[model samples]
Target: MENSLNTLHTIAFTHRNLPVSEIGNLHIDPNDQKERLTAFQSAMNLEELMFLSTCNRVEFLFVTEDIVDHRFLHEFFNALYPKLSETQRKLFADSAEDYTGIHAVEHLFSVASSVESMVVGEREIITQVRNAFEDCRKMQLTGDTIRLVMRHTIETAKKVYTETNIARRPVSVVSLAYHKLRDLNVPLDSRILIIGAGVTNTNMSRFLRKHGFEQFHVFNRTFEKAEKLANDLNGTAHKLSDLNTFDQGFDVIITCTGAEKHIITKEIYQQLLQGETDRKIVIDIAIPQDLSPEIIAENNVTHISVEVLQEISNANLKERSKEIQHVEQIIKEALYEFDHNHKSRMVELAMRSVPEKVKEIRSNAVENVFHNELASMDSESREVVEKIMGYMEKKYMSMPMLMAKEILLKKR
Candidate 1:
């Protein structure tokens, strides 16, 4: 099992090498994940697996003994994304970055800490990591290895965020969008048209509401979802279909959805404009943006896309970069701690049967070895003898484990 621990691996396709646009192509739909990941794990003979996807990254963390060379990667992507063309499969396989053993552990800590994120200071990645683990765990796709690693990973991330200046100021896409909106001098009474009820849209809408912008109309494919977000913001809810018929003008449209193509088409924009010639604000933070490119090219719209936010993120990252050394120090300490903890757990597992074994020995001695002698003794003498032996047995059972743990701690 210790050798198996060294086989832990991570395969990452992130914004560092791949464009965010291409990253979306790797996103396995939630409905397809269980079947896809399970089959892939079985085929690869993986001991455990966890899949994590974000706007700009897709990662596969697993424990397997097979060397993840080019051939392995080709086979990996081939089995996992069978629908992809040979060319596409090869492209992904070639672009993938992999790490093994302790390096893989370090990569996860960096990711959850947000230091490896496209937006380095954003703390949302921590929650994203935790949620991803939970989702994978629910599918029974993970085991003790991932569970132990994630526990340490989350702890290191929290320490990094709290102890250092990494997440000092808000630099998330949502916060950046809000800052852009604030700079635009948009009024609180401006009609805010929210175009999805997903996590991104919910956060943006609630953020806007918290900043005293009240006028909102949320639209989602699921009316109940839109209604839920609407209720939270003291706003109105509408089905996504109603967007075509919405005659009410919107000064700002904030849209983020799971649509493969543009949710807000050119015609939808024209109808939504209500003949107003004034400039409009559209925060299209969705990957493969919710706003149509034609709308941005043709209409008088101030579009805030993910790419635009990334440019700002790069500049803000310099300030956060100063704290990387500090964060790395914490991660190093955590890595050492995890080593010690893992060894201690191994000791506990190895000695788990000691008490039962000791009890069996005591039973044999009392019933078989000393049965004749005890039969010749009085009841009071026998009772006292049994109590003394039980005391010794208990101490004998606990001594080895306690001594082992003490030695391990001393070595640490």
Candidate 2:
């Protein structure tokens, strides 16, 4: 159950590790995610690392040049969260999991496939994973190991989607939210207000549009994003600040935002409820949440958070039990691929290690030659020398990675 199960170093700190609220402390601001990654790279000096932070989880997939133990992980977290409380620190220190080698590949593949989602088969996670991968690419943080694992992860996950019904029914958070809104029995032509113009809201709008609901008012912190989404949805845009002042009341409201504080607090709810009499439903898809609990207590309004949605979705997810075994089979096959590739790569590295080291020393010697022999030379000549060294280094490291069968046959 604990992540320490693996001896090789691949780590994950997720909802399984701590409560979401506690996980909040580990939350890196989206803007600061790259900075946090840079800090991890500098501190760990790892062989390879991939960082994934989502509303439901924060995962760190890494490899060390040498085998490491629990203490190495504890110290790693300590540096990452120096300000954590004793309890918070223990949650992270004691709970972080590392699944060494192929196990790491399996875990990542599971995540990419939505086996780890609160809602079993949420599709949005696919986008989130891709975004995380692209971010690492932008920061130039992805290494050869991470690239192979992520590519396999995507492939394995997509196979699950195509080959199974696990993703069927009301399995995603967005679709579940839409189901809840429909169950409210509000009129089809009811006035609707959507707060925040992110992905969830976009999906909600498209769902509503398909259902023939055209009366929509969109609001966001930035008027432009809201206006753009509004235009896309065939609706009017309003400033998020207009929540308190808007004279007309919508029959239903949906809000999902990144704001740390409740955008629809009790006070704001009262103002929104001011002008006219109408029953309302609020679908809050935001993490850190958008609507306060008190909004649910108001007589005419229903507030549905992600937790609420999960509870409702659980009943529908039961049918997916049969599909899990198939998913497991897919994972098993991916693990096989990962193992085969990893062993071949390892053997290649092992057989060539001494030669590689000699090459490394030669590289150092060449660098010295550059400094001493080429230093006094013309700029163009020195550039040519550097280019030649680059070419040789590439050639030396470019030997084919081989599986045991291939290596054995070649030996024969």
Candidate 3:
């Protein structure tokens, strides 16, 4: 059975301890995707494979019968991010796990539920997992197990969202910013500055607008991208160099940039303070952190980092206790179905081996009967003996075949 179904290994590497500077450098280069795929194809006998590359993490999930050596996985990682040193490699590689059957199903469901996300219940992760599944489909790399697992995970996530209030309020960094802004008693008419024109920033801008924030200023390292986002949102755009021009115009600053280091330092916040008409709120959503904690500790300023928001988000999640219970029920149901299917597949593969064994036994029995006939029987008697032996072989095997069928039926 072990030889038939294959062992499963799931490997994930993320920017857990890596500096923000290194994360920006590790951004997925579209041109390199094909090369990375090629390297994976060469390294393992993959029965199923999915590669998920996002701003927060890059993970590879694979299933295979062949025993995968660490060297192959190491090579694949090095190829994807050559900048990683031995220390970085160790940090990233520490999260690998091997799961078979039921454990794998549970793990996948947990991931879809955002239980494994850096920010729990972040809805963006569900979309990310869906996109990763689509990519796997595009590569023609998925099989029955991968497809079933993904389908179950997606369904479980939907159930979690619909059944739980985990997603009821704003839990994403952008939404959390809106919540924090409101909590800080910042008026809806207060001008807000959103730094970075990437997806996260764009989403944050939309969220702010949805909450009736009319005054917005967007800045990016690339002026054109920022301008495009600003135009769409009917806000103003500025380059990083022009950030000082706005001074105290912004009452709330929300930053989600790919900058390697702190874009908002003590000096910049001090300048804002110098021109302040009132207190200001700052939310840093970037992974490595867009705002330094030291700057946040200053007086007359309110700052919220991603880690702080995560705690708030978790507290909010706990408030939805009934919904979480419902989500747990959904996950259990989904896991049961997934595990049944996985075990059924293994049983089917095992049953396939039965036919060859039966045929070998039949051939050996026929050979012995023929040899005995040649030594002691006439042509007519030989024919009769052969017929009898064939009947007995079939009759004897039929019981085992029926038992296998009954086992499958009971599983169903």
Candidate 4:
């Protein structure tokens, strides 16, 4: 039987210092898809492989029988990011081998369960993982081990949500934005400006409206999308070209655009600062950052990056510590069941070989019976003998099949 206990290798890289809020600034070119696929093909002898690229992080997940060496990972990363310099190469080394065996399994579970997420229990990550799995399926790169593990991970996450309060409080980017605003003593009615019309932006807009932020403005590269979101939220839609125009009017500015470079540069900050009094809170949720860190350091400007939001997320994690113990227990139990069931399937495959052996024996017995009856038996007698042989063969194989079924049922 093939070994079902395949090792999982996962590598994740996110913004260095930004909080979870600023993760939206991270960017990857669509052209990198081929490079990533090729890299995965080269990196490991994987039974299954998946790559998840998001604004904040790039992660690769692999299921393989044997451990992979760093050379493959090195070449893979190099191929994926041909633009990476020597310094960046060192910074993004594959850390998978370091967490082999149990640690690796736990790490994967943690990620799938959202324990390692920037925002703990954020539901979007599970969807992202599923999408990655689907991509692997499209590439014909997945097998039973990967499929089972991913399915288990997803199921465990759902169980955690149902069995805990993790999702009840809503610890997503939108919720975190609202929390930050409240923490800064910003009034609920404060004029807020949200840039971008993507998932994160839409969520932020919805949260703002729910929390009674009456005055709002939205801007996106796509005017139609921005207008649609604004209309849904009953806010004004500003053209991306007019972004600089309202810089000073908003008390809270949240930008989560897909722009590769800084959208709100020093010039824009300077303009916002001229009329702004006190601290104007700006949250750059984009990976490359919509606002420059240098400008953020200026007086009267309070800038929060994705890394900072990660810290805030960490604090929020404390609130759910009670639930962690429960979720961990559930995950462990599920993992054990999954492993056991996988082993049982292997055993069933092994037992299936018994049926072929039984058939071979039955064929020999039937031949011997024919040899003895050839002189005395008629055609009807020969037909009856064949029927009896078939019945006897089924009876002989039944015990082995039943035993295999029993083992499978026991594991389940």
Candidate 5:
């Protein structure tokens, strides 16, 4: 059987190497992953695979014996993303950062621990990694090796967060947006219009609500989702279609959605303003911002965007960098533990057939070799002999595995 651990590799296109805009090009919708990733994995000859996509990063973690060089990456993107133009494909292949074996393990640990995030110490990446692994595992794209790695990765992340101060003074985009709005001295009762009740907006709205901001009107593509967030904020819900007719003036707009284009066009913004010239706060945390650029330039709108938040995050990272050394030390220990555990699991698998073989040997002794002797034994004596042999059989099944594990663990 293949030792998938030794062949582990990761091809990552993240904010580190590419701009956030370019990283967005690599996103695969969850609805399309089952078919797309399955075929991609088979085409790439990966034994096991997991795909993780976040706002700022997209990574392919897989196990295969083939070396991951420029040629391998060219073929990788060609097989997985054939729709891309030749130049786009070559750009991705050239830009990808690849890691193999132990380096791959360390990278995953860093990712789950949030040390590798664009905003260092943001805790959301751990949940993203976990959900991504579970999704790929459900699609049958991952097997034992990836499973083991993720398990250790999560454990290591938990330890890093628990033992270190990396996550202190939370500085996520949501919090940054809240701080910006507060600095504007916007009244708590100011009308808040929220567009798209996705995770980012949900968190942002909830943070505002917690800070005593009560007036909220949530509009989403799905009325039900809109209602859900509206109820949480004790506000009103409107379908996204109602945005044009939403005549109620707003003091602040918190918008983040998965739309490819601007959800708030120039016309929509004009109608939303209701002829009021007073300045408004608009927080567009979406990757491809929900608010149109024209609206920001032409109107009395103070816009807080993902790009602005990234600038703040970059500064926050310097404060968080003090904890990176401690986090990396934990990750180093986790890598060693994973290695030992992996070898022990391999030994356990290698010894799995021992029990059946021992059983077969005992059967041969009692049923074949000792058949005539057992036929002559009295009933009481036969029972005693059977008990002794059964006891011996149990020992024979367990002893070798125990001894082997002990020896292997000691060597580690």
Candidate 6:
């Protein structure tokens, strides 16, 4: 079991492994996430599979009997995304980075702790990891080992937060969007148009709600989701198609969607500009960008693109470098414990019959030695005799235990 556990593999196509262009192409829609996860499992016969897809990464962590290579990934992507050409499939395989043994544990911990994020110390990544873990479990793709490691990784992430100040500041792109809106001095009474109700805008709304900003008009392709977020935040909800009908102009517009194309184009921007009494601000946090770059260049509309937020996040990073160092040290300690615990679990799993095997062997030896001898002793003497026998049983078990360990070591 330890041998198999030690062979656990984590293959990731992350911001570090792939360029932004490739990463953007890999974004799985929230609706299709589960289907893709299931597809991966069925296609690969994965025993223990975990899929984590985010804006900057697409990672697959799984356990298999034999070690995996790039060829496996080539087939994996070929099955996972059939639209990809052979060249694209091979590119996906070639670009993926794998971590095995203890490095897998370390890498997982780093990711959960937000150490591997494009913008370090963004706490939302922990939530993203948690959601991925839950999704895997819901899909029945995880085995005991994966469950244990994922739970431990989440715990380690919490420890990083509690022990360090790395996540003390608002560092995520969504949170930065909220801060950017605040900095632009949009009045509290300003009508806020929240375009697209995906994770980014959801997070942005939550951040703004925390700061007691509530003048919102939530819109999404799915009106029900928009209504849900709006009702929760004490705002109004509208279908995205109703933008042209919105008689009221907004002082701030935040466009964050999972769509690949621009959701707010020049025409939409023109419609948004109608009836505006004050200067407007727009925060576009989507990958392809919900607002067109041409709209961003328009006069009188202040635009905050994801790139601008990233620059702001980078500027704030200097103040948290010390905390980052502290977190790396914490991750090292957590990795040591994870490896040790995993080894212990593997041993227990592998030697599950050892105790019973020893018990049977010891009982046979004791019966031969004391079956007749103890029958003639008094009751009190019998009790004392059994105590002595128990001590001898433990002593004898040690020899077998050592031999068993040798066998296990040889297997390793």
Task: Report RMSD (Å) for each prediction in the order shown.
Answer: 3.1, 7.5, 7.8, 5.0, 2.8, 4.9
TM-score of decoy 3: 0.66
How would you order the candidates by lDDT, starting with the best? 1, 5, 6, 2, 4, 3
TM-scores of the candidates in the order shown: 0.86, 0.77, 0.66, 0.75, 0.88, 0.79
Itemize residue pairs with steric clashes in candidate 1: none
lDDT string for model 3 (57-149, tens) is: 656667776665566557656766676788766655554444555666676677778665555677887888898888777777666677767
On lDDT, the leading prediction is 1
lDDT of 5: 0.88
Error of 4 at 260 (Å): 4.3
| Model 1 stretches with alpha carbons more than 4 Å out | 265-279, 292-300, 360-396, 399-412
Stretches of model 2 off by over 4 angstroms after superposition: 1-10, 13-21, 65-78, 239-245, 275-278, 297-300, 344-405, 408-412
Model 2 local distance difference test score: 0.74
Please give, for residues 117-144, the per-residue lDDT of candidate 5 as tens digits. 8788888889889999999999999988
lDDT: the better of candidates 2 and 3: 2
Cα TM-score of candidate 1: 0.86
lDDT of 1: 0.89
Question: For model 3, what is the C-alpha lDDT against the true structure?
Answer: 0.69
How high is the CA lDDT of each candidate model? 0.89, 0.74, 0.69, 0.70, 0.88, 0.78
The residue-by-residue lDDT of candidate 6 on 1-412, one tens digit each, is 4556665789888766666446656666767777887787878887888888776787878887665876677777777787877787877778888888678878899998887877778888888888988888987888888887887899999999898888886478776777777777766777789888877788888788878777999999899999999987899999999886777777788887867677887887788778554567888777656777786566577878766776676677677676788998998888777766676566556556766776887677668866787677899998887788688667665665566556655653
Residue pairs in candidate 6 whose N, alpha carbon or C atoms collide under 3 angstroms: none
lDDT, model 6: 0.78
> Candidate 2, residues 1-412: lDDT per residue as tens digits?
1122242356666665565545555666566667877787778776556677666577777666645566776667776776777676667768777677667778888888888777777778877887888888788777766776778788888999999888876457778888777787778888888998877788888889889898999999889989999998789999999987876667888887766667887777777777565667878777667788676776676777766775765676577767888999999988877666655555664556645765776767767744587667898987887788767666655544334447644543
Better of 3 and 6 by lDDT: 6
TM-score winner, 3 or 5? 5
